[model samples]
Target: MKSKVIERIAAKILIEKYQLLENFYPDLLSGITDIIQKGKIASRFPYIEMKEDEISILIKAKELSELKIIELWNNQDTEEFRALCSIYFDIATLLDKDFEFKNEEEIYELIKIISFGYLGEHNHFVKNYLISKKELIENISVPEQWNSRLLVTIFKGIVCLVAKHSWKDIDNAVILINQLRKEQKDFESKFLNTVNEDSRPYGSAELVSLYHFAKTVEILGQYLLEGRVNGNEFDIENKIKYHLSVAKEFANASANIVLEMLYKYFEAFSIKLINIKTMENKVTPNQIIELINSLPDSEKHIFIENGKYWVTQEWLCGAFAGRAFVNEILEDAVQEMIDYLYKHIGHDSMVGNSVTKSGFPNLERVKQYCTPVESEQD
Candidate 1:
């Protein structure tokens, strides 16, 4: 069967399953005009190709989309009702991933529905349904074998923890985090004990594990640092920040180790930045930029435009070279390194947010690259 056809059929089933189209149903003939004008629904379900009844329904959808029926659906607070709305949002978006439905109000409604479980839904029908979905998703692990298997498991675990937040208890969250921290520490301790400086450098398994550990720490750090559990801010923010800081340290260490393990394998390994100490033939930032410009468009894009670490890539490589050898050419590179640190580490820029609790220091470069928010409330 065609996947799109299956999805369309499934969408109807899901709407009925969630019982959304009933309570929030608009006039049967009301169409979502915005979807029609944008050609979103028309392209997917062409008006000419559809049966008479299907065409009527599509017209209704087009008009309802125009009238913002989704927003109206969100105003209802019942858990079953909110879940029904989520089904529509999921169906509309799944039909066209890039479609701009702008249905956050619907999503927020579902979030509210689930939030009731955190408060007092021990016997509620919605609570049981949410828990069952959570369990089903949690049970499906990626079918990978070997050392990479650990990475898959860890990744799934992280995702499950994130999803579980809506229905999980805060005390449970704290307990789970602490347990993860202990597991992480224990795993690291055992790995370190198994390998010392004289041992063979890390293999793919070790590399994967380090990456997973870093990501796990980052996720834990964001959760604990942000204090997102029930609206009440954590009673011990200091303790939480400290825990997150330790996670940050681990993530940083993992990044450094990954760089050390993989840098030589890259194609750009031949180009070395001059060391400031020995004062050799050093390249200026302009010269470096020109060299980067000389590269093929594809390589240049990877180096300077969009890939991970692209902005910091050049500076970091130069710093690495400076430490690798003692040459006079690297003197300028060293000074440039200092300049980079001074500019990024200690300054605030135009994007400074004086109101945030974290008081994150402004990064001029990050501000320069930041995407603007289209909606004011966002």
Candidate 2:
């Protein structure tokens, strides 16, 4: 009975090492037992001399690594978690061949080392580590049988997202996502066949990976659209605004600026003219100036003296000028009017100063669609 118990323990390790499942376990056990009975365990080729010191060293190293990880989590040190993940990955690689683990948990802890996004290292190491031991992962599936597929897919997606810009290499990201999608057919059979609904959260990691892959595709699509816009000379006022409004929902700050500029340019094309019937009924620029000047100095300064053009030739100038109020309250609406030209139209001949200085076109030319006199009273 004592010998039988020893055989069972040895068989467990052999099954884990070779990744043999229930069907092959008995034959694999018999083979290992023959080798042990023949005294080939220690005298054989490709042998590792397992000593008490080596045993104690691996135990201490694993314990130290686990404790450090726990400390990092408790301290909320994101960088430290990233750092130790690297250390554990190296240890897992070095121990793969000759080290004898006492049980499955130790082996599983090493596998979890790779699952924590430690894969920012070389891709070849990551790819080989995942692809080489397909059988081992299949037999030792702990979190779920399909966790290996999801983990490997996420690692590949992160690599593609970080390296690519302007839609470059998006195909690589698509390939990883496509592989995950293709696995859906077998999912019900491989996963749903044995899983009970009592543990609803059991397969959450798989769902998370699916969701993340969808987001990655959306982000990549935004970059691609931006690149297309940059290459083409579409009507900036009309076409670009529509594209960028959608893009801004997905992109970061740099892309947001692009969207804002496009909106401003489009607004320049759409001016609201101040309609006056005839000279009797008309409020000409001069009349508007006189009316502005007749008020008290504080009020006069707000409109005419400042060379404020409330009318945009193409769109309502007051509307675009008013955006500065978002940052501060404008107590002096006239000084606000004075600074408006300096803000939108520059001292230089080229109009729409902000967009022009930013290297966007003089889109104010499109403002010819509406009539606004842009001149100061002498």
Candidate 3:
């Protein structure tokens, strides 16, 4: 029988309703020839890279200096400049790049621009990209790899909590986070007592867990810190930069722990390969092979499985490396990360109030975990 394909529901909702690259750019250019004319938008830009060029042109030709450029950048035709600037501005906003824009209007403007693109030429690339991202995001499911699988369990639990903003979602989110706090009481009786397997140094799957924990935690924390948000017209377009920033910080903390664990595992694995038994320079390749050949079948099997921690191939003597399995998981997640930022850029670069919103719970977040959204939305 053929296996069923699982669609990541939360990721899809985040993308489409939140306007992650969902036609915002194509919409901006729909009436490009008319709304932002050739000679008219001297200080505006079409793409992200051109913003600097636009500013330089304004300064050189029109003789606008630093303050004047700021004035022009700020005070230009609201609809025209916003639509142009936001391609870069909104991306920066989502990324919290340089600084965040405080005005709700600016955020609202992004929604408008993305909505415009929805009606015009659709950017299937952005949509496809975001949809593809949905596949990468999973709750921390593989718990067997950790020493303290319960901590792994906690990480998974907290991840779900902070992943949404509705009244029901927030209530549960609060409950989950508090549960993690309470778990400090027992479960081997150490506070936040993670596996601490730096010595045994478990597999890289732990790192994958850490990565998802980071992603999930960030999403959830953002919801709590920022309070509420809506996707599309239904309070979904914009919200909670402060909360997101905090959540990202927390996620990075988990990532750091994962990094430390991976490095230590590699260190331990490397030591095993070296010639500590004889205490001379490291053993010769032939000597290492001979040593392995002498081992019994069970030892050999165990050696190979654990040896995978140090290197990939069977023949190598010593390259001093671990498999870095986290990279595989990270690779999938990183693509979604890139797409999310790009979609925000697309959304941010809109003009006027003629924006749009889709009732979210479609993809990016809706803690219950359902099938992905493109099939339903499409």
lDDT of 1: 0.35
The C-alpha lDDT values of all candidates are: 0.35, 0.38, 0.30
Best by TM-score: 2
Off by over 4 Å in 2: 1-52, 73-90, 98-173, 197-378
Clashes of each: 25, 5, 22
Q: Please provide, for model 3 over 1-378, each residue's C-alpha lDDT reduced to its tens digit, 9 standing for 90 to 100.
A: 123223356334323422322233344223222221232333244343334543343223222121232344434445433233333222222222222223323222222223222222223322332233223324324333232443444333332332322224334544554554454345323322444555223333433333333333333443332322222222211222333333334434455443343222222212221212123221122222233344333232123233231212111111231111211222222223323323433254221111112212122221112222356654
Of the pair 1 and 2, which is ahead by TM-score?
Answer: 2
What tens-digit string does per-residue lDDT give for candidate 2 at 301-364? 2323234323221122323432421112122332333345445644453346443453312223
Number of the top lDDT candidate:
2
TM-score of each: 0.23, 0.30, 0.20
Output the better candidate (1/3) by lDDT.
1
Per-residue lDDT over 86-200 for candidate 1, one digit per residue giving the tens place of the 0 to 100 score:
4333333323323221232322223333322222222133334445445443554433232233333433343333344321332344444455445654464455555665542
